[model samples]
Target chain A: MRATGDTWPHMAGAAAQPVRRATVATLPAVKMLRRALVALSLAGTIAGLLRMRGKGGVPPQEGGWREVGVPPQ
Target chain B: MTTPIVGLAGCGVTGSRVLHHLAAHQVRVAVYDPSPALARNTRVVRLESAADLMACDLVVLCGPAPHAPLTEMLVADATPVVSVGDDLDDMQALLALQPLAERHGVAAVVGAGMAPGLSGLLARYLAAQLHTLDELHVAVHGTAGPQCARQHHAALGDAALGWHDGEWIQPPGGSGRDLVWFPEPIGAHDCYRAALPDPLLLQRGFPTAQRISARVSATRRDRLTARLPMLTPPHAAGDLGSVRVEARGAGPHGERVSVIAGVAGPTAELAAVVCAATVGQLLRHPVAPGVHALGDEALAGLDLLHHATQLGVRVQEFTGVARATSW
Candidate 1:
């Protein structure tokens, strides 16, 4: 993961632990607030995906998820 | 130095065009899809899963949207995502990451396809000229198949919401509109609000717009208008899709000036050009922080206008900004 210098608003309570915030903004958040954002992002994604799945929308890793750059000859 | 690698999901029409463009530019390109037969490109990669996208410097999602969740996982540090299809989970996820992307210098361009992508682009263009912009109207109607949702998908359950009338208004109930859009190749295609004024992205990307909408164009007027309430999430339609958008504003002397952008063709080419235009523009300039439209900063110049014109997108400027002028 690339280090986002300061573009993101780091979560609400993340200003205090500047070291932790600096150390881990990637998946395995070093700070708790960063971890919380990741968790929420993940949870929202799951809920969004599940909602679409109900409508027969494409599920992650399904056949539609199949990569096809070329059409059949 | 090696070329930047880009992984494209769903190599259908728009995806393929993007792949071809990237390949032509000598950008190493890989793809993730279940299907075997694909388009002819320089570095066509066969992937076992979407995770393959993680390998590239940039990832352009061209398939259905439920793939949003994958973004948090697939998009690692530094790698920004550009979503091209009906699904906007990628855009939402990107928005969630906006502060990071801006602060850390990571680049994530959302809705980088035709409608949402170019719609965002148009937002940039209109917002630039306005003195005190309040409202912007956008429309779209150009795709040739059912954009229906894949079966059993649940992420699509959310309704279509656009920033409008001050805040994001997810209008309830479906109601068709009697709109006449001037599309390319064919003139004056019928269109209605498939979703609400889709220009909602403007709120985050372009600060000037009070509202903007890019809706679906139909063959006949009011034929496909859905009740705002009935209008659910943007499900796939069974037939081809066509789109047109007009950016309207109140001129200084109580006059309205508008810019009309019309693109007609299969989804991929348009998506590719728009995405390419978005990337091409972004690469050339340093985009300011705060969410932005495709045309936000990079896409306003003559290059995009020429490229779009070369590809058959018509962008016209009118004297008055009036919804009444639209069909």
Candidate 2:
């Protein structure tokens, strides 16, 4: 795909680098937090499914756009 | 020059909204859709065949993905084309026709829909405010129609593509989760990397950027069940959708700066306004012949945003609260 010079910009002299994979130990706290979130989400999904029994799907919500500030010039 | 008649090829959820926007602008449109019930409005002139759309000055294809063949046909016939296809593979194919479009002297705008469309425009708008742009990160929130919902489902399971320091990276989809905050009503959501075409289209425009990545908002269940068929049928039309574009670069003084801008509304409505605005721009000032994304420097991002605003799409930028001088 890189050979197709027309599609992508020529990478003058930059050499591609290998992606590094981090071990679980490198971010154990983050991993634990993610696991906790997933568990909570799973529980919530089960509860929602139970609530959905014999109910038509939730109605789509309505919304309106509100501009906070102007885009940078 | 006289007002150019626009051709519409699809009248699905997004295409039908595109028709409404165009009609609101008082633009004459020639429509051709396989489903007879899709385009029954009196304003648009219905055509019997898709090929007849070539007679119009320009054609806006809001059809399903893989619009490359029809786009090629229109360009070959010297009719400018604009496509709102969001599929990654299909966008790549449409973009590959750059040489053909240039040779035919007919412009072809690819990915003129919400994320790749409005997202690219916002990226360019923010890039213009910086001294040197280094990174661009995009997160999309919702889907428009059933077709869009299905595409979203597939994208979550496909290989994700990203641009990093001039090299392409393919990572497993449904990974790399990040929390993104959109505008009001659609606050924060968990976004994950997916097979989005934003990186591809944005890379074409901002080739020098060091990193470019895109993600779609999804739930934990969405990621877990990505590889399998959808357990539940997707909504016929999704609720409010939003896209957040974050750009990191240097300020005018060489200081680090980050700009985040977004737009939230009905995805189909946003896509429709964007398509109509691009068509309006094309009619007034035709771009050079070739495949162009919305944010390409050649196209005026600010002007396009202004046009979209006129068509009822609101753009919002995040501004951090000012620090107190003394507390």
Candidate 3:
């Protein structure tokens, strides 16, 4: 299928590589660090969402009559 | 070749995206917004009022229903206008302008955004391949953030209209509220009836279509938040969305066509591309003056599906299903 340029972010090409077998040597400490990092990232995302509370009540206009234009710049 | 100067009425989410695509295509753009400060920020030339936008080749309207007066003024001036906003509201506004558009001999393209826009056009495209269309279903699954989340809630909160047995009726659940399987990753999700204008417009455009329905689904969190507006939850769906249009009809033997349009970025960008492509087509080929929808005369010359595919809108078509499932 033909894909347009960078306009579609999800269409980005993945690195070409051969599949590799997982090693048996597992590092418990490293795995714990990874889990901690994921938890931290999740917390950060939740905080960001909570910070986005709307101002009390719907705005008088709701951008209905207002211009919702974005500047080209 | 001289660049065609196009006028833009709104610069909001979808409007701004339209401007971005138009600028990339080297189209001269003039913007008209009532707020002077909003106008001053744009790189395009700012006009004093909506009437001033009439000086351009075409006008792309991104304003609200309350802006119908401005649209009335545009059609009265014989300016071709394309609307990329609310499906139901825009349809009403276009109906009111039909007489003026006919008198002025200019065309108006309504419901040119993602769901109502591409959904209706896709239905028409598939219907053309069928000998007798029994039903058409349009479903939208979006993975968006707070901004779109609020709108989603509002849409579900409102009564949705659907076409069944050759009549318009409110579906028990506004959205279908049934399990609809979209493409992979989006997989199967619960959808509810939405007040999208596609069902109504599709029925009008394809009178033989006995059943027409449109529904929408969001991520788990967004879906829950839509039902409970008080909970401003984080986005669970990431940033991907898809619109699936399926038509069940007879072509020789019974068959069906299913099209899934996948968009990677914000839906507004895809919507902007649709509007920009429409504007480009209108500039190259002026349609007969009158009121029209996405699948109407104004966009007759445009191979909308082809243009959409070229703009990174992933389109997949599947045909030849069992007769029982065709209905």
Chain B: TM-scores of all predictions = 0.75, 0.95, 0.84
TM-score of 3: 0.71
- Candidate 3 structure quality by residue, lDDT tens digits, B1-327: 667789998776666678888888888898876754465585678878777887987899875444466667888888888877554655666667878889888888877777767776667676666778888888887733344445556667666778898889875334446665555555656778876677867776678878888888745554455555646553633256666777877767565443333333356766677788778878887777777777653464677756765665555553223122111
Off by over 4 Å in 1: A1-73, B39-43, B88-90, B100-104, B144-160, B218-242, B281-292, B297-327
| Model 2 agreement with the true structure over B103-195: per-residue lDDT tens digits | 999899988989889999889878978899999999999898888888999999999999988899999899988877788768878899999
Writing each residue's lDDT as its tens digit, candidate 1 over B82-187 gives 6664554445655676566566555566666666666665455555565556666666655522242231122112344566766776642222344554443444
Q: Specify the CAPRI tier of model 2.
A: incorrect
Candidate 3 DockQ vs. native: 0.01
Which structure is stronger by TM-score: 1 or 3?
3
For model 2, the stretches where C-alpha displacement exceeds 4 angstroms are A1-73, B39-43, B321-327
Error at B259, model 3, angstroms: 6.9
lDDT of 1 at B167: 73
Preferred candidate (TM-score higher): 2 or 3: 2
Candidate 3 C-alpha lDDT tens digits along A1-73: 4565465555454323445779786699999999999999999999778767534433222111111111111
In the predicted model 2, the residue pairs found to clash are none
Worst 10 residues of 1 chain B by lDDT: B148-157
Q: What TM-score, to 2 decimals, does candidate 1 have?
A: 0.63
